[model samples]
Target: MKFQTIFKTAALAGLALAGTSALAHVGPDGSAHHGFLTGFLHPITGLDHLAAMLAVGVWSAMTTRRLWLAPVSFALLLLAGALLAQAGVAFPAIEPMIAASLLVVGLLLAAQVKLPDAVGAVLVGMFALFHGAAHGQELGAGVTLAGMVLSTAVLHAAGIGLGLGLKRTSAWLPRLVGAMVALMGVNMGLGLLAG
Candidate 1:
C-alpha cells in the first residue's frame, strides 16, 4: 500500500479505537454524564491543555521531515501512558514533566531553533505520555476517557495543521507559539507546585 494510504488508515484506526474505548468506560451513572460536547471540549478548555496540544503540533510541523511520525509517536506513547495510569502505575514526576513540556516546547518555538528531527519528535512523544496519563487519571476507564482522548488527538491535529499552514507566513510564528507555551509552562508549574 502507498505510504499516504497507510498513514490515513492508521490515523483513522487510532481514532476509532479511542472513540470506542472512551464510550465503553462510561461511569456507573449509565449515561455519559459529561456528554460528547463536554468531552470534546475538555482538552481545549484550559490554557495548559491548549498550550500542550499546540506545542505538539508546532514541534511536529517544525520537523518538516518525518512529520507524521512525530504525532504518531505521541499518540502511541500517550495511549501507553493512559494505560499505565489506569492500571495505577506509579510515576513520580508526571506533573513536572507536563510543565516541562510547555516550557521546552515554548522555548523551541520562541528561539526558532531547529532541533534534530528525531530529538524533536522524541521530546513531543515524551510529553504526550505525561499529558495522556493525567487525562486517564482524571477520566478513569470509560467512554469519557475515550472521548477525551479522541478530543485531544483532534486538538493535536488542529495545532499541527495550523502550524504547517502558518509555516510560510513568517519566521516568528514558531517563536510566538513558544512564548505561549512558556506562559502555560509557568502556569502549570504554579499549579503543580501549589497542589
Candidate 2:
C-alpha cells in the first residue's frame, strides 16, 4: 500500500511544472542547477505552480474516498503533457488555465464539492497537463524530467499533510485558505489578461 501510494504520487507530481518563468534549478533567472535540482526547483519557484500543486493534495485528503487518486491522476497526465511539449505540441492560454486551475480546485475544496473519485481525479489530471506543458516547453537538457516529477510528489505530500492536520483542528481554516487561493487565481488571470 505504501509503495502504491508513493508510486501513484510520483506519477502525478512528475507531470508538474514551474510555469515558463519558474522552470529552473536556481532562481528562474539565476545560475543553473543540475537537471534534478532544476526540476525540483521549478514548481516551488512559482506561486501559481506551488498553490495549485499544494491544493491537489489538500483536496485529495478532503475527499471521502480514493485519497491519492487525484494527485496520481494529475502526475500521469502531466507526464503525457510534458512529453507533448518536448515533442513541440502547444496549448492555448496555459497560464490563464493554470490560474483557473487554482481557482477551480480551491473553490471545489471550499465548497466541499463531492464527486466520484474517478471523476474528480480525472478533472485534476486534466489541469495538470496544462501546467506541465507550459513548463515543459522550455525544458532543456539541463534538468532531468524525473527531478521535476519527484518535486511535485513532495509538494503533494506536503499539501496532504497540511490538509489532514488542519482538518483536525478547524475545518473552516482550510476552506478559508481555499477561498484565498481562488481569489489569487482570479487576480493572476486578470493580470495575465491585462498584460
Candidate 3:
C-alpha cells in the first residue's frame, strides 16, 4: 500500500479508538489538582481540549502566512480567560461555546480556509477564552495555569507537525481528521442537549 493509504487507515482506526466518551471532561474528584504537572496533563487528558488545540495548530500551519499568530493568540487569550475566571467572572454558555470551538476549528481545518492573520487570531482567541475559563474554574493557581498553557503549546506543535507531515503524504489526511473532529463536536453538542 502507498503511504497515503496507510495513513488513511491509521487515521480511521484512531477515530474508532477515540470513542464517544472522549468528549467527557471529568474534574479532579475530591482533592483539587494544583501546580504545573497537573495542569500539563489537563489538556492531554481531555479529548475536546486536545482536539481543539491541535486543530488550531494544524489549521494555522496549513493556512496562515504568519504561522505563530493564531497559536499565540490562542495561548495569550487562554491565559486572560483563566484570569477572568479566577476573578469570579462568569461567561454565559461556556460549555456550548466550547463545543462550538471544536465545530469551527474542525471546519476551518477541513476547508483549509485562509483568513488574514488578525482574523485567524481573533477566531482562535475566542475559542481559547472558553477553554481557559473552563480550566480556570477547576484549577485556580498561577502554576497550574502555566502548566496547562505549556501542555497546550505542545499539543499545538504536534498539530503543526501533523499538518505539515500529512500534507506531504496526502492533503486529505488532515482534512479527514478535521471532519472527524467536527463530527465529534456535533456528537458532543447532542450529548450535552440530551443530558
- The lDDT leader among the candidates is 3
| Candidate 3 stretches greater than 4 Å from native | 1-20, 23-31
Sorted on lDDT, best first, the list reads 3, 2, 1
Order the candidates by TM-score, highest first. 3, 2, 1
Worst 10 residues of 2 by lDDT: 23-32
How many pairs of residues in model 3 come into backbone collision?
A: 0
RMSD of 2: 9.4
Specify the poorest-scoring 10-residue window by lDDT in model 3.
22-31
Higher-scoring candidate on TM-score, 2 or 3: 3
- State the lDDT of candidate 1 residue by residue for 1-195, as single tens digits: 799757755653443223212212221232324555655666666455566676777667765476666667777777777678778775567777877877787787777667777787787888878776766565545566666667777877887887788786756646655675676676657755665
State the lDDT of candidate 3 residue by residue for 26-97, as single tens digits. 432322678789989988888888889998998988888887889989988988987887787878777777
Q: Residue 162 of model 3: what lDDT?
A: 78
TM-score of each: 0.73, 0.81, 0.88
Q: TM-score: which candidate is best?
A: 3
The TM-score, computed over Cα atoms with residue i paired to residue i, of candidate 2 is 0.81
Residue 78, candidate 2: alpha-carbon lDDT: 70
74: Cα error in model 2, Å: 1.1
Judged by whole-model lDDT over C-alpha atoms, candidate 3 comes out at: 0.81
Residues 128-191 of candidate 2 have per-residue lDDT tens digits of 9988876676554435567677788889889888878876877676776677667667777666
What's the number of clashes in each of the models?
Answer: 9, 6, 0
